[model samples]
Target: MRFIDSHCHLDFDELADNLTKYMSDALASGITQFVVPGISLAQSKSLLAFSQKHPSCHISFGLHPYFLTAHSRDEMALLADLAEQNSEQLVAIGECGIDSQCDDLELQQALFKSHIVLANRLGLPMIVHHRQSHHLIAQAFKQTPPQFGGVIHAFSGSLQQAQYYLKLGFKLGLGGTITYPRAKKTREVVSRLPLSSFVLETDAPSMPVFGFQGQINVPVRLIDIFAQVCQLRNESEDEIAQALYATSCRVFSI
Candidate 1:
C-alpha cells in the first residue's frame, strides 16, 4: 500500500519544525515519496534544503499566485537563473499558476507565464496551482506549453477542464479536499476521470481531509485521501494505488 504525495508544502513553518516526526508518520502509513512545492524564492531554497536531507522528498520551485505581492518583475529572471544553477537538484518548476480569485489577476498571469516559459525552455515539468482560473491557465499553457508537462495541484474543476489539462499533458493532483462531502465537483470529477490522469497529494499543513478537521495535514494523511478516492471511484485500493504511483512517476519522471 505504498503511496506518493505528488504535491505538498513541507517547508512551511508548521511542518518544518517537526519534519522528522512527520516523515516517520508518513512512512508508517506507507507514504514513501513527497513533492514539496515552493511558493516563493525563500520557500524554494528551504524546500530544496529539506529535499537534500530527505531522500524521499523532491523539490519544485516557483511563485504561487497568492503571493503576488511578494514577487517582482525581476523574480522571474532570478527564478530562471536559480533553475539553471540548480538544475541537478530541481525536479519541477512550480506550485505556480493563475488565481482568478485574487485581486492581482494581471500579476498572477504574468508570473504564471514566466514559469511556463522557463519550464518549457528547461525541459522540466510545471506544477500548477490553479483556483477559479482554469480557463486562463489553460490559455497560458496553449501559448507556451512545457515540453516535460506538469500537474494541476489540488484540482477542483469540471470534467471538461480536467480533460483539457489531460490533453495538454498535465496530471490532476487529488488531495484532502476531495474527501469533503461539500466537494461535489471534485468528487464528481474524480469518479469520472480516467485513473491514469491523476496523482495523489496532501498539500500538507493545509487541506486536511474531512475526518481530520482542524488538524494540520501531513503526508501521512495521504492514505486517507487514497481511501476516499477509492471509495468515490468504487475501485480497489491496490488498483488505485498502482495507477496513481505510475501516473506520478510518469509526470515527475522519478
Candidate 2:
C-alpha cells in the first residue's frame, strides 16, 4: 500500500543533498508522501524551498525544544509570520512541543503554547514533538486544546497517554521505536489502539529501526516499520496498509 512518512527531516543536509535519490527510494518502497517539521527558523527556510520544489513533501513551521536557546522573541514573531505567509503551503504548525529532558520547561511551554495559538489562528493542525512530557503536553492542551489536532511525532508511551492524545484528536506516530523488542509497552499500546489512531513515520537520519541502530534512518525504511507494526496488531498487511494510508491523509489533510 502507499504510505506517508508523517515526519522526516529532508531539509537536513544529509537527506537534502541526495533528496532525489532518497525520494526515489521512498517511492520505490511505497512511501509516496512525507511531512517535514521545522526545528529552527533557518532550517525551516530551506524546508520551505524544498517543499516548493517537491510536491510530495508537506511541511510545518515551528521551533524545536532542544534548540530553545536559539529561538528569540523576534525569531518567534518571524515563525508566526512564516506560518501565516506560507499558510497555503503549510499542513501543520509544528515539530514543536515539550521535551522534559531539555532545560527550562517553562520556556518550552511558552513557545509551545505560542505554537498552539499560531496553529489555531492559522486554521491548521500541529505536528507535536514530545519526550517524557506527556503530562506537560496534556496540561498545555487543557489550557488550549488544539483547534485542529495533529500528530504526536514518534510517539512512545503507555496506552493511557496514547488514548489521551487521541481523545484530543491527535494521531500517534508509530516509528522505529516499535521495532525494538524492548519497547513492550509501546508495542502493546500499538496492538491495543484503534487502527485509525495510528500513522507511519521513520524520523529519518535518527531513530533508526531495530537492526539499523547507529545508522542513518531513511524514508524507505517505512516499509520495515510498517512490517513491524503489522506483526504487533491483528490486521492483515493489506488492511493495515490501507488504514494507515487513509488515516495519514485524514491527519495532514493530504
* Error of model 1, residue 110, in angstroms: 1.2
Q: Least accurate stretch of 10 residues (summed lDDT) in model 1?
A: 67-76
How far residue 155's Cα lies from its native spot in candidate 1, in Å, is 0.5
TM-score of each: 0.95, 0.97
Model 2, 103-219: lDDT tens digits are: 899989988989999999998888999999988998999998788999999999999988988888899999999999999999999999899999999988789999998887889
- Name the top lDDT candidate: 2
| Regions of model 2 farther than 4 Å from truth | none
Measured with C-alpha atoms, the lDDT of residue 210 in candidate 1 is: 91
Q: Given candidate 1, what's the lDDT at residue 36?
A: 84
